[model samples]
Target: MLNFFLVNRLSSQVRILSSLLVMLLVFILVTVLVKVDTSTWTMEFFALSLVCVAILSGASNVLTASVFGVTGRFPLQHSQSLISGQAMGGTVSALAAILDLTIASNVTDSALAYFLTADVFILLCIAAYLLLPKITYSRFFGLFSYYMNLPDEPTDSSSSEDPVETVDVSSSKTNSPPIIPILKKVKVLAACLFYTFFISIIIFPTISAGIESVEKYTGSIWTNKYFTPLTCFLVYNFADWSGRQITTWIQVPGPNSKMLPVLVFLRTFFIPLFMFCNYQPRKHMYEVFFKSDIYPIIFITLLGMSNGYLGTLSMVYGPKVVPKELSEGTAIVMSFFLGLGLAIGSAFSSVVHLI
Candidate 1:
């Protein structure tokens, strides 16, 4: 029942939600149609296509991450790089939507199957790229550097300090280092993981179920479920773009702004909820689910918009909670939590369908 076309006024939060909604709706509908006949394709052919898409998407995510990381780390012109990276990420999302839609409509059975597979592959690839080697190195080094610099620790007496200055090296050693405050770090990591896990639990299952319902009732298959990925991609991008705009332009009076965190949390929760509510199972739901199709489409659009805004805000503000040096590391940990959450959600959703 959500109004799909209503353009909400632009707050930092609203701007994100609106964009996600618009992009997702367009991409999901178009992809669904394109994927309709892909069941006719051979699995081997389909898989090859998927691999190609995965490589492309993975490369894009890595490039975006690298740009952002390098820019953030640089002493000079960090802001410009950061902005450029975010913009690029947003552009990727937009491009993905367009490609998915175009491919969905014009592609033949074999072609559609290959395309869908590729999209999924790309998604997984992006995730893998985000998770592997560099994540660990960045996180460990960042945390290590932070902990090594704690003010609580006294200078080592062996190096040379006056007698008064040399006092109580033992107490200083017992005190945690200044750079990465262990307690704060733990709390942030825990919060990120917990939120990611729960949200994933809600989202993945709902999406899988929705796809299954579409397949079962509509007589579609995996390839025809292109809408799922398209919707996700668009929503993520739109929310991200909006968040960047909000944070950049809207400044609060105080040194610490309450708006950022509040907006970020709102962005995070709304998209999943929007998706869930739209696809909520009803009696004979499959029979009636696509009768109008309009309702779900609207939901998809809204979900995308919300996601776009929230994602962007989270990316921008995520590092601020920790030290500058540890930003990349924090991002890696957060990405891990996100991946784990998505995996668990997908598994659980599949199980629910079997039941």
Candidate 2:
């Protein structure tokens, strides 16, 4: 999709148009889903709706890649801010889900509230996006213009004196397949991103939801009802948000930094470790060493922090290693790799039940 846009000189509108379309799609889908009674909705239809939502979610990630790609050219700070904001967005959504689940009268109301809230937020995002171009001297407009003006390819140093020679060299390079060089340049960053999201997405939502505070750790009725999910959600998201913010002050694993991939891959240990916890489905299978609330909370916090820090490090550092013209592509590719990780991790989660 982006290649088509770039080839036709439509790159300038890629992010805005895609994001606007997605927001609108989300609004309509949520509204329709809310209106239909789940009791009457067939299992197949529900599954179809989930598939549509997943497609739209992937589209949203593409838009995020576009935005991040643009920001990558400016400075590391801009990329860090983009990632921190994403973490904050997750934290907010998790809080909303928690509130709906705990306070609503029943599951139906909770489901309705969640969809309604999502629709409202999408509407607001659309409104804000519409207002962006109208604001004079807006950073959004400035960034768009900056990206629009960037050369499609880096200028050769010899081009000023011999344009023909430059063209010939570029044509030869293109003939050999241009993507290979880019893949080589960004291998480390892409690997880091892949491993980062792969580790987190596999354990979260599915596996983490299975784990619980042991029977002995229960406090009150509320704790019995929502303590495990709520505590885990808050601890993980708060830790993620905090770790991202920390990057604003502390910079390590800068662009092309070797430690980033190492740190990210190390998180694979989380899978087996989490699986051995007192997960609701498999409590009888293991000794459940992490039975206390403190144990999982501490580990989850670390997991979240590592996810935020290392993921941010990869994005911020990726563009710096490539030529200025290729920076946007590099960032976009990294985002795509992250999505790949998520897909693989989600697939892996499906098999967790068998264990």
Candidate 3:
């Protein structure tokens, strides 16, 4: 909706710059949250912070996609970079949490350390964005500039030879709404994205957070204490990063293949499967199937890898399916759908206890 309103009024570069400002604001907010005593904070402050993060995240997605779309030359590799960055973020957060558990004296110290690390990364992003347009190669391709000169596609003279074809082309151009056409073109991509995140978000962070190794297992105490979280978050991040990296080598079963959505939908099994995997809530009712800690480790690794692989495929392929002029808007729309999947999946995760 922001894109609908602001795409015409502001250049993509300006919108992206505005998103950077929003990110900086978020980092500042995190800093304040960390520095201020927890006793002074209330639910309202935390709620407001969440609201701010959601809005800024959506804005950033729109602006980034807009820049890619408007530039016309940015390719799937660029989209891959964005997806890889997201995976990297999870990997970093996981490492930070591990460090916090191992080294931090208290929860407060851990929070402070995590927030400071995040702030530094946010600053680095701001610096990179600031310098992007100043460098010639980045200016030409990385940053979207209204004045960037691009060669126009050569018109086909054969269309002029046939009056019916010319009239059909003109009429089609006149009657179609720009966004609607692109949306139709990339409908499968949107659905693929929705399912990918829906399956992932439903099981991860919520359901996965509850799973633990059986007490009867003879693994080390640290492994028993931290194994679930490690498998759910840290191992997941590493496996996810590996899955995303694999795409760079092979993009098998290209975007148009019917099998992609099936693969995504099949991932729904992980929810129930993870739920049954020595989960704390149901440990009494269902006997632990696999006594060894290795079962969940293997499952989560596969889950994370699938999430990264399918997600990267959807992100990179979605834009390529659309015309270059519409790719940016299409990418943003894809992001919106991806967020929708997460929203729906999160909502479902909240209610899984009723099941």
Q: Residues 30-73, candidate 1: write the lDDT tens digits.
A: 34656555466668547855764555444333344333433333
State the TM-score for model 1.
0.43
Residue 171, candidate 3: alpha-carbon lDDT: 25
Per-model C-alpha lDDT, please? 0.42, 0.70, 0.71
Q: TM-score of each candidate? A: 0.43, 0.82, 0.84
Tens digit of per-residue lDDT, candidate 3, span 144-193: 35334333343454544433222222223223225666677778878988
Best candidate according to TM-score: 3
Task: Point out where model 3 deviates above 4 Å.
Answer: 38-44, 51-72, 139-177, 216-220, 283-287
Query: How displaced is residue 352 in candidate 3, in Å?
Result: 2.4
Question: 2 or 3: which has the higher TM-score?
Answer: 3
Backbone clashes (count) for model 3: 1
Runs in model 2 deviating more than 4 A are 1-9, 106-112, 130-177, 216-219
Better of 1 and 2 by lDDT: 2
Q: What value does the lDDT take at residue 231 in candidate 1?
A: 45
Q: For residue 276, give model 2's deviation from the true position in Å.
A: 3.0
